[model samples]
Structures are given as structure tokens and as C-alpha cells.
Target: MVLQGMAAFRIICVVLLAALAGASTAQRPTYRAPQHTRAPLPVGATPEDFVAFANGGMQIERDRAPDDELAEHRRLVSALDGLLPQRKGMVDAYVVSIALDSDPVFGREAREAAKVLARRYDAAGRTIVLAGSDGTGPSDLPRGSPGHLALALARIAELIDKSEDGLVLYTTSHGAPIGIIYNDADQGYGAISPNRLAAVLGALGVDRRLVIVSACYSGSFVPALANADTAILTASAGDRTSFGCQSDNDWTFYGDALINHALRKAQPLAAASAEAVALVGQWEQQGRLKPSLPQVLIGDRATAWLAQLDRRTPAATTASVGRPATALLDQR
Candidate 1:
């Protein structure tokens, strides 16, 4: 009897070990190298040439008049036309929402957030959206190229009263420790570094500012963008990544919680951020993922501006019924 029992126990142990090994092997990701390598462009190649090269050499022989440059110029004109007309007396908030990635998910989230803010502030002329098309044409905003973003900010500065008005800038994209990824696939590749962003804001003289960066490692932006007159919020800490960035989803985890859920209720920006953080914590815990630890830094001088904005538009407890439920998937 004892010998039989020992044999059964050994069989069970072997089965368990084999199952663990199979699970480990299944968890390992597969990688593939690119099939074709790009040829280097000539030293004096124009920006158009570079774009053509990057886009698999298709646009090299395209006509110049009806090409990318013309399209970009028309897009810029559309963006400028979308900016809110400056008001006469009371301090108003102008929002410029940008989706820095080419992904459809970022574009959708950015457009939705812009809609919420515009409705909250009654800012028909005060809101501008810069995002790539998601095929739905939510706002028909311009592509969020780096140059376009800079131009938008400069234009906004010109349209608003610098001292009295506030700028709410929201950007959503994939990020690395170095900076936020700026890629309009086939158009170009670049990054928006913390210093560069700070310089843009400073140069515009838009002192009362609210900057929300939704991306992995977005906390890196806090140090440079945070100032006495600016309030900054990030989707994750410098070392972490947030979830739910799939193309099919309506909103990301942070975007769903913060803009879709919390901010839709007309709460203060600080309060909305806190609520979003708590909600994100719950979502991560439920999914058995590590905490994203969304970060916020509201400078002392920015608090008064935020308070005034809040007073002008009181908080409503009503939730937004338009947004879809937050998904649990993660795609970086």
C-alpha cells in the first residue's frame, strides 16, 4: 500500500511541473525583425523627400501641387478656423486637445475629452482639437504633427487675453522615459521632450495653464511643465504604464476615468484627478496588474486659477451617459 501511494504522489508532482513549464513557455512573447530595410535619403533631401522615403517610396514621384504639403496647409487653415473667438470681459478657459499618436484610440479619446470640456465651459470658439482621423470625423481636426501643435498653441495665444484666460492642453499618446512619442505613421517620427513643451508654453505667455498628459511614463513631464501658474496631471508614474489603449476601445483607463467619468460631472480639476486616480487603482487591482500610480502636481499659484474656473462653472453631480465602459486590455 505504501509503495502504491508513493508512485501516485510522484505522478501528480510531474504533472504539476509540466503544467508550470507550459504556462511559462506560453507567456514568452515572439519577436520578428522587419522584412525590408529603408535606404538612406540623400544629404540635401527635402522634408517631402524624407516623408516619401519613410512611406515606402510611394510618394517620391507624386505631383507637388496636390501633395502632402498642400494637404497640411489646408489642415492648418481648418485648425485656425476652429479656434474660439476671444470674449470681451470675463476670464474664460480655452482648450486645445491633442492626440500625439497615430493610433485611433488616442484620437477618439482626445476628441471626446475636447467635446466634454467644450460643453462644460460653453466654449464654442474657445476649443480646438488636433487629432488624426479615426474614420468617424468626430471634429475633422488637423493631424497632430509637432509643427501643427506649435502653430496651434501660438494661434491660441494670439486669440485669447493672456492674463485673464486659461489654457487647458490635453495630450494622449504612447510615451517612453525620454519623452512623449510623436509619430504620424508614414509622415514622420519625433518626440516632444519636457523642456521643449515647457519652452512652448513659456513662449506663448499662457501662464494660467492646465496640462494633462496621458501615456506611459508621462510623469516625466511633471518636473518641467509644473510651475506656480500651471497644473499638470499624468496618466502614470515615470516607471509605469497605463492600460486600455486598444484601437477598438472608446477610451483608455485614465481617459475613461478622468475625462469621461470624473470631469464630465463638472468637478474641479484637482477633485476630478483624485477621483480618477482612485478609480484607476481599483481597475488595476481588479485586473491583477501593477498600479499605474497616476500623478498630479498643482502649483500653489495655479490653485486660485482653478478655483476661479470652478466658480465660473459649478460642479454637477450628474454622470455622462455617452462614454462607453472602460476596457481592461492593455496595448503599448
Candidate 2:
């Protein structure tokens, strides 16, 4: 958005390529269909429909909220403008965490993930969180939607130095072969495909980034988001289902392992990711659930920024808090 001219064109071109190529590996898993426990998923949607949606985003006619509610939502989204500019001449991390669905589980995960990431990246003033209510009283934050995500990225693009600053994005939601599903019962429904996400990041000129997507079929995003300067981690493989998405829960299987446990320490991101993957594997095995096969890819160019952020990481470890992800399994 900084240079809306050529950059917008490039984003459009990328989306076109994704639609024409239809390269997303996200598959509707055979084990369990995404349902209404946590978030409403596109139960019967196909991958082709997903690509088409990615090419031309949803134009849903959302039910109108009260005038006061609308104003409040706008105020919350506008809060992105309050984020501080990146400290010049330093390699800073700009953390953006969003809960894509209104499922209280995602909202909870996104809220904590934002804090965990902010601490790890030393992004105190550079962090922006967009999440709905976590079912714990009223929320002051705005809900995570495709539109808000774009606004957050665009604002970061304006403030951060493209070459010097890095982005750490965490998106938690339900999924389909399509992508991350955004279902707010009161608001409406939509989707964010891998290509659309890739295009937005590319258009923003944010090359150094660490993107974590937590949802079923999340691995499908890897191919589209992969870049020489990027690192990516997902909750599951293209056709797999990640567990622990109950609405009353605090974290998804991926979030509990990666953010609540591994990331609360003084360590490199790759090491934390490794530990998380192992934890998820053990959980799935014990529960006799399908393997999510969470995926992680760190490019050669990512090392520089990773090192910089690792240096900023706190030396002490934070004890894991709240309900455990395994609680979901016990309930079942």
C-alpha cells in the first residue's frame, strides 16, 4: 500500500497466478469434517471454489449491527494507527496476530499468541492484535477479518523499513481446503486463501517474515507463502486435521505446543518450532487422533532476522498457563 501503483498490480498478478495454477495442497481431510464446535467451516466446499474465492474475495452482505456497534468496531480497527513506527536503523520485528474466526477458541489463542510473540520479538510498541471476544467478558479489541488483516499489514508497510524490519504474523482459525475460514455468526463469513495472503505480504514489501497459521489443512499455505527470506509454520499438513479447537478451550493443539509452551522460553524460533512439532506428535499419538503433521520451513535468508530477534528474547522462561490443549481430548 505504500506504493499502491505497481505493488497493487503485483498483488493482483500473484492472485491471478494462484487461481490459474490452482497449486494449493489443502485438501478436505477424510477423518473429520470441520463443524460447529469451534468455528463454522465450509463443510462441502471444494479446492477449486477456494481458488476462485481467492481470486475474487467474498462480497458477503453482512447483517447490519447497531450504529453504536459499528462505530466501536471502526474505532478498534483504527487503533492500528496507534502502533509506533519501527526504530530506524535497527532490525525490528512487527508482530501482527489475528484470530480469523469468531470461535472463542481462536480469539483466545490469538490474544495469547500476540503477547508471546511480542515478548519474543521485543515488539512492545510495534505489535497489533485483532481478535474477537474470548468468552471472557467484553473485548476491547476488534475481531479478526480479512479486511482488518489487510489494513494492519498496510499500516505496517507504511511504518516499518522494508529492508530492516521483520514481520511476525499469527493467524488462528478453522480451515477448509480453501484456506482459513472467517466465521463470525453475528458479523458474517468469508475466507483467506494462501494466495491472497501471499499476495498481500508481497505487495506490502515485507520480505523478512515469520508466518504461523493454525488450523486444519494449514500446510496448503506453505507453497504459496514460501520465499527466500521467509519462514513458515502450520498446524497441519495439506489434508490433515489439527485437534483441540473446542470453543471453550484456550488454545488449539498447535498454539498450546508452539506458543504457550515452546515460545515462552529463551530460545531460537526454529528450536521452539521443533519442540512444538514433537509435542503435537505425542499428543496426537496418545489421543489416537489423526496426525496434523505441523509444517515448518525456514529459508536461508531468515537466519539474519531470527538471530536479531533471538538476541532480544527474554532470558527467563514463562510457566505455561490456562487450560491445557489435551483437555479437549479428555472431554471427547
Candidate 3:
């Protein structure tokens, strides 16, 4: 009888422990990966082929006939031919908008923001876009691959008389602590390190620069990109994630607040940044999410340059016309 009782007790204890474990697991938040639509590609395509397609660079296919390679090369050449010619004289500001992800949301936001910046800065002939194929349309170039982005910057650097021209580079994508994610869907995938970006800027020799990185953990770029002649703006701090990255949305939390709202006004970027940061905080609090804490670093030289730029360009006399503020309140 004693042995039977002891066995029964052990079984009961095991059952209780199992129940507690199950309860604990139920209390823990479950993680669901965000669903993404995978882009289509040719069968048996290699990574090299994907890279070539994404960058619009060399064509590589060992099995394919020479004619096939030539055809692809010609197509890329035609695309390159369509790019806008660089301006000859000093430009007020040259804007290069890059949407590094294949997500349509980032592409749309980047393109819209680029247009706004161009209009505000009177840089109609000086703006370039490198983005993925979102339903919206083709950018100045297809594929925001690292190679293409680097090439675009180099080309702009070579064309512009760097003495008086300022470059505004706005990049939007997903990010990790190491770097901003660069994925052209099935075409190619990579990351742009902060150091790589700094080197690009250094090689460009453009002293007056505004670098805006809209991505999670983008604050990691600030320390590397910030300098006497540069201003760096990031969507979130190194340890947090920003929201509103849905494909159906017009913009992310930071992009909407900063580029679509604050920057749309005639205020200096510094003031606009502050306003956007505050707005983001409010949105995050309302949603009961952890604070993203958008970040900005304004270099000494950029301050004077921005002041001069603001003086040259007057603020919009009219209010922004678009989705009402209420519509964007729940966006994040």
C-alpha cells in the first residue's frame, strides 16, 4: 500500500509540473514572423545571376547562350541610358533616394519623399532614385543593390562641382544592429555597413551632406556617418524597432512624421527633426509599444549650411494636402 501511494504521488507531481509548464508557456508572448511575398525568378538561377540582375551590372550565365547574355546586357544598357543627365553648375542640393528593400512600402515612401525634397530644394534636375520594383513604378534605376547605390553616388560625386553642392541621401529599409538590410527580393541580398557608407561619403568629397536612414536600429550609423560637414538622421535607436512597415501603408512611423509631415514644412531640418521625434514618442506611447527613440546628429558645418539653404528656399505658404492627420494616427 505504501509503495502504491508513493507511485501515485510521483505521478501527480509530474502532472502538476507539466500543467505549470504549459501555463507558463501560454503566458509568454508568442512570436509570429511577418509574412512577406517572395519575388519570382528564373529556374536554376545562381546567386551571381541574381546579383547581376539586381545591380544592372555584368551579365553572367555559363549555361546560357551568348545571345542571351548579350540581350540582357543590352537591356541593362538601355536602362542606364534613361538616367537623368547631371547638372553642370552648382546645385542647391542633390537628392539621392534609395529604397534598399523589395517591400513596396519603402519604395513608395522613398520616391515620394525624394520628389518632395527636390521640389523644396529646387533640385528638379538633380534628383536620382535607386529602388526596387514596387507597383508604383520604376525608379531612376532598378535595384537598390549595394553596387548600384555605390555607383550612383560615385557618378553624382564626379558630376557635381562639390565646392558648393550638398547631397541629401535618404535610405529606407529594414535594419539590424550590424547594418541596414539590402534585399532586392529574389534578385539579390546584402547589407550596407555604416563604415561602407562613411567611406562612400568620404570618397565623394561632398562636404555638405544630409544622411537620413529610415530603418530599425539605424542609430548605429550616426557615430560612423556624423562629421563636421554631415547631418545624420535615423528612424530608431540602436536597440529598438520602429513600426508601420506594412506593404499597404504609405510610410513608416518615422518616414511619415519626418519626411511627409515635418520636413514638408519650411522649418530647418533640426527643428523638423525635433518635432518628428516628439510626434513619434506620442504615437509609440499611444500604441503601448516600447519607445523607438529616433535619433539625429547635426554636425557643426551642416548647421551653417542648413541655415543658408533654408534662407534660399522659402517655406510652403500652404498647408500640406494629403491623408489627414487622423488617418496616420493609427499607422504606427
As for candidate 2, its clashing pairs are none
> Between prediction 1 and prediction 3, which has the larger lDDT?
1
Q: Using TM-score, give the best candidate's number.
A: 2
Candidate 1 Cα outliers beyond 4 Å, as residue runs: 1-68, 135-139, 314-325, 329-332
Residue 211 in candidate 2, Cα distance off native in Å: 0.2
Residue 199 miss distance in model 2 (angstroms): 0.8
Superior by lDDT: candidate 2 or candidate 3? 2
Worst 10 residues of 3 by lDDT: 19-28
Q: Write the per-residue lDDT of candidate 1 for residues 119-142, one digit (tens) a residue.
A: 665566788888875534332567
* Model 1 Cα shift for residue 91 (angstroms): 1.2
Clashes of 1: 2
User: Residue-wise lDDT of candidate 3 within 1-332, one digit each (tens)?
Assistant: 01133443343233223222211111113421112333233456554433333333222122435774465445444544444555455346778888877566677778877887777666676777777544444333455667667766776776666766788899997765446666554445565767678777787787678999998778888987888889999999976877665554557888888888888788888998999999888887877878999999999988876776677565663345334323435644
Query: Candidate 2 has what TM-score?
Result: 0.84
lDDT of 2 by residue, 125-182 (tens): 8898887766654457876778888888898899988887899999998776667767
TM-score of each: 0.76, 0.84, 0.73
Sorting all predicted structures by TM-score, with the top scorer first, yields: 2, 1, 3
Tell me how many residue pairs clash in candidate 2. 0
Candidate 3 global TM-score: 0.73
